[model samples]
Target: MRKGIIGDILHGEAAYIHDLRYQMKMKTGEGVWRPYHLAKRNGNLYPTHGLGPVAQYMNLARTDDQFNTIISYSTPAIGRNKYAKKISQRKTYGINRF
Candidate 1:
C-alpha cells in the first residue's frame, strides 16, 4: 500500500485545504504588501497565488480530475484599518493619505 505524505495525498479519498494567510505589512515606505483599496476593489487580492501548489499536488489538468469551479470570499478589512491607524498615529508608515 502507498505510504508517506505524497502517497497518502495521492491515495486519499478526501483532502483538506489549508493555507497560511499573508499578513499585510508595510515595507519601509513602500506601503503595505496588499493594499486595502486594491483588495476591496478586487474580490481576492491574490486570487491564484495559492492555487498553483495545490493544483500541482492534485495533478489538475494532468489527470481526469480537474477544477470545475471556484468560490471565493473575503472578510472586511478591519485588521488593515486597525494596523493603518496604529502606524499612522506613529507617523512612520509614510502614508500621508490612505
Candidate 2:
C-alpha cells in the first residue's frame, strides 16, 4: 500500500511562522525593497506554499506517479513600486526611511 509522494512539505509552513514572526526585521523592510528580485538558498526558495496543494490534487503517489524538484516564480513588482513612486511624486512627500 503506497502512502504518497515521499517528500517533506512542512518547510512552507515553518518558513511562514519563522520568517513572518522571528525574522521580519530582515525579511520585510524599507528602502528599495523587492521580493521576487532575489532568491534564497541560491534559488527560488518559496515554492512549497504552492507545491503542497498541487501534489495533493495530482496524487503524485501512484505506482507510476513521480515527483521532481520544486519550482518558484518571481512576480512583477509594478504595484508595489508604483505605490512608492506615487508617494515620492507627491509635492509634500514625507515618507519614513530606515
Candidate 3:
C-alpha cells in the first residue's frame, strides 16, 4: 500500500506558507484605487502615478499593451444642456456649483 504520510509531509508546508502571506497582505493596508481619466475628445489613458510597481501593472513607457482604449464624443447641443442646468442652479444659489 502507498503511504499517505509521504505526500502530506512534502506538500503541507508550502500550502501553509502561501496562505499566511495572502492573509498578511489582507490584514495590512496594501490596496487602493488610483484614479484614471480620459478626455471627451482624445482617446488616451491617464494614470495618476508612474514608476515602480504601479508602472509595472499599468505598463507605462515600456509597452502600450497594458492600456485599454476608450473613445468618447460630445456635441455642442449636449454642452448647451449641461450649461443650462448649471446656469439655472447658479442663478438660484447666486454662486457656481462647480
Candidate 4:
C-alpha cells in the first residue's frame, strides 16, 4: 500500500484494490442484527486500513487539494446473490464447482 502511494506521487492517479475480511462471534442465540453487537462491530470512526493514510500523505486534507471525492456507492449484495444461485444450481446438476 505504501508502494502504491509512492507510485501515485511519482507517477499519477495509480489504481489499486484491497480486500479485507473480518469475523464476528455472536453470543449464544444472538440475532445477527442485534443492535449492541452491530454497534460494536461497526463503530470504527477512523479508517485504520488502506487509502486513508495515503490520501493524508498526499495532503488531501488541505483545502487546496486537487482531487475531488467520488464514490460508486454500490453494494455487492446483488452480485453475491447471483453467484450463490449459480453455484447452487451447478452443484444440484452435478456440474464442476469452482
In candidate 3, what residue range of length 10 has the lowest lDDT sum? 31-40
What residue runs in model 3 are displaced by over 4 Å at the alpha carbon?
1-56, 64-71, 74-98
In candidate 2, position 5 carries an lDDT of 65
- The sequence of per-residue lDDT tens digits that candidate 3 reaches over residues 59-96 is 44566544354333323334433543554442222112
TM-score of 3: 0.17
Q: Give per-candidate clash totals.
A: 0, 0, 0, 0
lDDT of each: 0.50, 0.38, 0.29, 0.38
Error of 3 at 14 (Å): 37
Model 4 bad stretches (over 4 Å): 1-31, 34-49, 73-98
Clash count in backbone of candidate 4: 0
lDDT of 2 by residue, 1-98 (tens): 02446654443221221222111123345322323232112334565655566555555655466666555445643444444445454221112210
Which pairs, if any, clash in model 1?
A: none
lDDT of 4 by residue, 22-88 (tens): 1112222332233233233333323333445666666665647755654433333344344434544
Per-residue alpha-carbon lDDT of candidate 1 for residues 1-89, written as tens digits (9 for 90 to 100): 22255454643233334321223345533245335344446356455566766676667778797879865566665555555666555
Q: Tell me the deviation in Å of residue 76 in model 4.
A: 5.9
lDDT of 4 at 53: 61
Q: Can you give the lDDT of residue 86 in candidate 2? A: 51
TM-scores of the models, in the order given: 0.50, 0.36, 0.17, 0.30
